[model samples]
Target: MLWDWGYALEILPVLGQAAIITIEATLLGFAMAAVLGLVFAILRMLGPAVAWPVSMLIELVRSTPLLIQIFFLYFVLPKFGVTLDAFTAGVLALGLHYATYCAEVYRAGLENIPRGQWEASIALNLSLYTTFKDIILPQAIPPVVPPLGNYLVALFKETPLLSAIAVLELMQTAKILGSETFRYVEPITLVGALFLAMSLVSAALIRQVERALGRRFVR
Candidate 1:
């Protein structure tokens, strides 16, 4: 097999295209996680009567492998006549799986808020929703920014698992290119480099966010 560097260069555009899909999936999935995770976190905080099962569910999902969850959605859902396209399945699976971790992240964030804040909200007789909307979240979110960014980075890497369900992400595209050219080394190398580039770029952006949010938070 000829190790043609130019062949890898030619496929750069194709890899870029697939990277976009991976980024879209990561962003959308993390957005889903942020919202749903907050809900679960709030549910857990309110009381065990409502919270216990929610906590159990979150822990259960967290304990199990995300890959298994993806496989279950792709394979088992069909048995019940619920069919999903590969992209949708990949997005939903990734979203649901990561939501568990995000819930814990949010929960930790909420807990970090001082008891005085909660007490003050109660003293002000603010409704729970009002208290959270006006006070708790505004304060909690900034400190969590760094960790949340880390999760985003983690989610970016996990996109390759989508390939198991046939979503054509970066690694998947590399696999196809490799098979076609019978040159796994070049294609796979390019994929790894692409992933590393993305991760480094994301981390840098997150650091900027951390600094900006940190200043506002301290004010």
Candidate 2:
């Protein structure tokens, strides 16, 4: 009676559909974070004139709570004629928040590259684009893959926060089901189990990526 198998089964499909939204938001947000973070890292390397403002921006984002950022993007920005729907606002908030962390990771990775390598690239008369794309990123990215993957998992967990904006991700869907059926036990339990399973799977995939990158870089 406490756990209704019939009801759990009934709501499974709906939760699964919502899970797709969660996954989509996680992947899209992470992709944006990864790319934007790289740009931030590179820009910081450009010069003091550029790095000062970029550093300030990164610190500001890192200092704020993600929920506040989500609310600002979803609610406040509309007042400035920058309206975004729930999902878009949520994804942008997730990306921008995490991108600060990702930028730090990238900066560490880029700094680890040898000064000799930079000298060699310059000696070879390589363009900045070629130096970064062909030489720098290939070497820098491999060492940082594990940390970036950790951020991927962290970002996935953060998707639940998107529910605050009524994005209908997995947690939001589960909450809705609980309210409609007045059966919180089944839906809430299922959501917890789903999160655990997904986190474990993501960890495994991260390990695989780490190993693959290690092998490639070793060669």
Candidate 3:
């Protein structure tokens, strides 16, 4: 038969396990990206003294292919005695690769705050940390939620790339199923459907957050 219901049913449990790994990697990698990106943005905004090196680091990561980064992390780093397992290496690559993009998003958000806000903070003799934490990030982060949400979805999709390093994500599970059964349709289609469903759910959640933030921003 072209597609076997029995095979599909048998594979569901396997695929479900893989999906959990995918979700875990996505959430962890995105958390790293979010935090690291904020740090990068803050350092760049500190002054030209720090900005130039940070800017170059961001550019280097942005210019490289994520696959290369993954391979380097998984394969090459062990040569230097900095070894990581497949999942950790893949997650780190995803986090660091997307961090450059997240940094730009943060930079734009921080820049969007009016110059007057900075001047007022300085005039008040506020500490730099207080100005950023109390005055800056609150205003900057709200407007950037949609963009960051987009990145979250993007990073989730990118999890499949982890399979290159033997992470056994959804797509990898599907591929293994296909190889074992000598049939591709059921496993591949199931993987695609699961991805679509998750993407839609993420987009909906993002919209809800955006609306909530919009209300709060206006208030």
The lDDT of each candidate is: 0.89, 0.96, 0.95
TM-score of 2: 0.99
Quote each prediction's TM-score: 0.95, 0.99, 0.98
Q: Give lDDT tens digits, candidate 2, residues 1-219.
A: 699899999999999999999999999999999999999999999999999999999999999899999999999999999999999999999999999999999999999999999999999999999999999999999999999999999999999999999999999999999899799999999999999999999999999989998998997
If the candidates were sorted by their lDDT against the true structure, best first, what order would they fall in?
A: 2, 3, 1
Relative to the unseen true structure, what is the C-alpha lDDT of residue 180 in candidate 3, on a scale of 0 to 100?
A: 89
Q: What is the per-residue lDDT of model 1 for residues 86-179, given as tens digits with 9 covering 90 to 100?
A: 8888888888888888888898899999999999999999999999999999988888888888888998899999998889998889899888
- Model 2 accuracy (lDDT, Cα): 0.96
* Model 3 ranges off by over 4 Å: none
- Using lDDT as the measure, the top candidate is 2
Total clashing pairs for each candidate: 0, 0, 0
